[model samples]
Target: MDAYYNCLGCMNRQVRVLTMDGQQHEGTIVKVDRNNVYLKKESNGRVQTSAFYPGYGYGNQILTLSLFTLLAIALI
Candidate 1:
């Protein structure tokens, strides 16, 4: 649970998210799991939830951080 407090979404959030395709997005993480992370984004005056997978068998994909803790790290 501690790990969830410092995730990428929590830290450095002032900057928009840069996708692999060079797209920019603004959002905050609402939940995270071993397989994926759930994010909440503001779209057209509405909030939408999005899911992201960090790719399995990649490089150090399994991070030991909870949803909230990971957001904290992102903020730091």
Candidate 2:
């Protein structure tokens, strides 16, 4: 999906910035929009939320079609 909708909410407050190479940055999903996902890194074993952005930062993180299906199902 070029844009993410309700992904942060589907994430159930947990969000991770994923890299194409499978590397991931774990954080709490604070907000979501068409552009970027905002995540606040886990600090002191507690998570925080941040503002949203336009796109992924690490690299071109493309979500496979199957992943999209999974997300859709999850959202429902």
Candidate 3:
């Protein structure tokens, strides 16, 4: 887990993270803590104009994953 602590320097950078269970997450690193890494998950859906706001798009969601569950992390 100490190795994952090095992710602190990757804050605000785009990354692709693979977990032990085979799940993959791609996003910008939002925050890294002692127990978890938070990612502002990128959305793959096509952009849609909001009904009320013509130019605004939906915001990406934040994902909280346990540092211990990570199998790999790569910068994209």
Give the alpha-carbon lDDT of every model: 0.41, 0.44, 0.71
Model 1's C-alpha root-mean-square deviation from the true structure amounts to 10.8
lDDT of 2 by residue, 17-60 (tens): 55445545565454555555545566586533333244645432
TM-scores of the models, in the given order? 0.39, 0.42, 0.73
Which of the predicted structures, 1 or 3, would earn the higher TM-score when compared with the native? 3
- The residue pairs that clash in candidate 2, if any, are 35-54, 36-53
lDDT of 2 at 43: 56
Predicted structure with the largest lDDT when compared to the true one: 3
Candidate 3 differs from the real structure by a C-alpha RMSD in angstroms, to one decimal, of 6.9
As a TM-score, model 1 comes out at 0.39
Error of 3 at 58 (Å): 11
* Weakest 10 consecutive residues of candidate 2 by summed lDDT: 67-76
Candidate 3 C-alpha error for residue 37, in Å: 0.3
For residues 1-76, what per-residue lDDT tens digits would candidate 1 score against the true structure?
A: 4443334335424323444444445655544555444444666976443333354333312222233222322221
